[model samples]
Target chain A: MKPIIEISGISKRFRISHELQPYLNIRDRVSQIFSGKKATSTEEFWALKDITFSVEAGESIGIIGKNGAGKSTLLKILSKITPPSSGKIISRGRIASLLEVGTGFHPELTGRENIFLNGSILGMRKNEIQGKFDEIVDFSGVEKFLDTPLKHYSSGMQLRLAFAVAAFLEPEILIIDEVLAVGDAEFQKKCMGKMDEVSKSGRTILFVSHNMGAVSNLCSKAVLLRDGKIAMIDNSSKVVEQYLHDSVQMSGKRRKTISALDKSFTLQLPYWVNNAGEEIPSYSFGSDYKLRFDFEFHRELTFLNIGIAVMNKDGSRIFTSHSVDDKSFQSFSTYNGKMTFDAHLNIPDLAPGYYQVLFGVADEHTHDYVNASSEVEVILDIAETHKIKDGANGILWHTGQWKKVG
Target chain B: MEYEIKPAGRFSLNLSELWEYRELIFFFTWRDIKVKYKQTFFGAAWAVIQPLLLMVVFTVFFARNFTIESGNIPYPVFVFSGLLLWNVFANGLSNAGNSMVANANIIKKIYFPRLIIPISSILSAMVDFLISIIVYFCVLFFYGLQSTIPSILLMLPLSLLITLCTTLGAGSFLAALNVKYRDFRYVIPFLIQVLMFMTPIIYPVSTPDMEWVRTLLLLNPMTGAIDLIRSAVMQVPVNQTAVAMASVSSLLWLIIGISYFRRTEYYFADLA
Candidate 1:
């Protein structure tokens, strides 16, 4: 089978001007023209360099990259919103891109009118929109406010309406950006389900996202981009693992030490330690992890509290732990000397992914907070030898046993 | 199902591609017309109010002060006739000139025939012109002016066609230029202001004292459409030479405007 879209050696270059002003007035332009001054003070920056890729029919390809990795640029070039500075792209079948929701929606227009307006903007014919208008309104659940102007609808409602229009668009190839980042969790799930249905119907999809979980779930193949070039192209899981590994290394060391200027105290951490008190970058799933902190104080300290927070890659806090939360450590005061503090946290059966630990110290009475100089990354790798099947489904592994009562 | 986009060169008019997107053009024009009066208190009345009010002001000031000849026609009707066409040209030109910048969001996100923006703007202006013509007929009735039914029917649409063509020409030129150098925004309204006086909207083209000035006015593309309209609708004698000159110039402006617009439209998404 032939590929539906083929891109070869595509590159985009934008000229960066050093001048303070982004735009010139008519007077300055006229004077410059008369004076014959050349405007050559520009630096060329390539947003994409020789990116080559192709997608077969009915394939869903996920493009994973950090900001400025040319993901959006590649999508824009494919959508024909902007021309590439060099290279060629050959595409078959109708193409529609949803870089943003509500691209042409008018604030003053009623929800009903905006549906048609946005539908046509996405290349839907009038009859096609009319045919599925009721389905769209039903999916959006904005039936009560259909006649009201879009400005009166809440942002969530507006987003649902916009998504409905794009969802109903039956193009052969659909290009989507990070539009799923909006709305609540339930709505995101619904959007993901809708995209899954579309892909199941044998449509070509090019999805760009920062959410590794969504990309892994929806895409069979993934392309990782770094520094405007293809870093790796492989199965979704392997690409995501490589991307996570590369990101961890890019941040350099995980352990750090900080000494107070007044010599009041010094905090040091050797590394992230497992339950066995051994340094490790990764831990087996469903195991307790420990972090040991050594502190030295020249002056006596009172009412010192230690805190730790575990966060996911997207900076969402998984949970927080503090010494104050424990009954024995409350109201504890330390003398002027060396002391060791240890935090033991049981890792919930978390899905196999990277997590980070944040440490901070504070006075309970004064509420004066001191941040840790560095954070540690905890990689919860699925145990290779254990072979626990179907356990690592969601963020937490709920251990509810199933019984064949019938 | 298949499309190719390459860097645009000197002149390429994708007329077939434009035709394929005819529905979008219709939607854009309809949206503009609907949104124009959507929340307004006066609704469509504002369309007629503009040219009607301008005619009253010009008739009060110019007819009262100067001994202007209107070919034995009433000054109010004469000026209104001229204002009718002028309103279309001026409104259409200004609307089309700013349409690209106004629809910058859509232009940046979607790929369509960029010419649709300016064309739809002109189409909306034509709607306003059509509304104002009804008032033109009432004014003709009030003044008790008699014109040959056949000639009025024939000349009305022809004059409107010429005005529409001229507006499209100048409007697209300014629209394309405005995307790069927004100075055209300030320049358009001022140009229209000076052009109103130059095109014999308030004064007759054939001023008895200044043959040289009359000949110069004849060179203006609008002078021909105005003279043709006056001759056909008001039964004024036609200036054959002026009509020929105006027709030729208007066509020339149309050709040049479209060619220039087609050449530069590809870069609008980047520059705008």
Candidate 2:
């Protein structure tokens, strides 16, 4: 089978101008020419370099990397929204890209009108849009507001309408950026399902996203980019694992410095410690640990809640614990003085990786009393005494009884 | 259809590629026309009202004040015809000049013929031009006059076509420039104002005792078009020299405008 798209040694260079004014007026240009002062300076920034890749006719490939890794540049080149500074790309079929939702949606136009306008802008023919008009409206669930102007629709509704138009596009190749980062959870799930359906239909897809789970689930092949170069390309699961592992080392042990002042109080940065009250680099999953921070109160504060939240690298919260959760510390209060606060914790069965511990103080009633806060990242590793599977299929784990009922 | 994406050549104007995206130009034009009239009190009436009111003003200020030679045509009828074509040129120029910047969002997100943006602006102006044409005919009828020239109807569209060509050329040139140097945004309206006077819109090119000024005004592409419209509709003897000059100049401007636009369009995404 032949590849449907071929990219060879494509590179893009941008000249970063360091002029004080973003744009020049005729007077300034004329005066500068007479004065012979070529005051502007520019530096060359290569956004992509020698990015060679090819996709088979039915393959779904995920391009994953940190921000500024040239994923967007490559997509822009493929979509022909912008030209590459050098090299070339050859494709055998019509390619459409959804770099952003609602690319040409007019605010004053009705939802029904925007559907047609955005569809045409995305390279859909008039009859093609007409044929799918019903499906697109049904999918967006904006039937009642079809004639109402788009400005009145909630932002989420607008996004759904935009995505619905693109979803019905019958292009031979589809490239999508991180359009899934918005909208509600249910809508995101719907979008994911739609993408899954498109991938199964044997068209080519190139997806760029920070959602590792989505990438691993939907894509069979994954490419990792770093500093405008292809860092790795392999099976989706393997590449996802490597990216997760590398990200841990890349952001190693970031610490928040003590803030100078606040109206209510000031708190030192939080840190992880074990039973011995000594700081440790990491704590094994399921082990008892404590995160402690010292605070100096400026005035009497009653009914305060000190809480800590554990979040994954993607910033999704695993769980949260508040000091008030303990029966003994249900009504903790602080007076004008220095005091140390500690929250004891035990991690549940979670995937072994780095997690961020965000600790803050808040007034239980006002919620606005989160007058001071800080966060610290800590590593959670497998327990040395326990044996576990080499590779985990999901983010969580729980012990289940193994006696066979049969 | 297969596509090979590479660096654009210096002067590559791919008409076939433009042909493929022709529908987009229509869609863009529709959107512009819709948006321009939406939420307005007068809607398409504004199109007719604009040239109609301009004709009233010019007829009062210029026709009554000065004895302008307009052949057998009533001064008001002659001025309305000129205003009809001049509005198309002026509106088309300003709209196309700012079109790339106005549609910068679409240009950055999708790929189509960049020329479609300016072309659509010109098309939307044509919509208004058509409305104004209807008003012009009504005015001519009210004046109890009719074109004695048997081929006046045919020549009318021909002259309008020349006007369209000239506007497209000049508009695209300004549009491309506006994308890189947004200061052209300010220059466009001012340029249009100066150009209206330079063209023979309000005053006839055959005004007496101004031979040098008449020659300079005829050099303007629009002067030939407006003069042609007068001669064809008012049954004045056609100035063959002006008609020939306007056609060649319009073509030259079209070539120059589109080629300059083609050379600089690749950077529009970056600069706009």
- Report DockQ per prediction, comma-separated: 0.46, 0.75
B171: Cα error in model 2, Å: 0.9
Residue B147 C-alpha lDDT in model 2: 45
TM-score, candidate 1, chain B alone: 0.95
The prediction achieving the highest TM-score against the true structure is 2
lDDT per residue as tens, model 1, A217-240: 788888999878999999887887
Residue-level lDDT of model 2, residues A128-167, one tens digit each, is: 9999999999999999999999999998899999999989
Write model 2 residue lDDT over B102-165, tens digit each, in one string. 9999888888889999999999999998888778878877887654334557678778888989
Best candidate, DockQ-wise? 2
Residue B45 of model 2 has an lDDT of 96
Per-candidate fnat, comma-separated? 0.46, 0.81
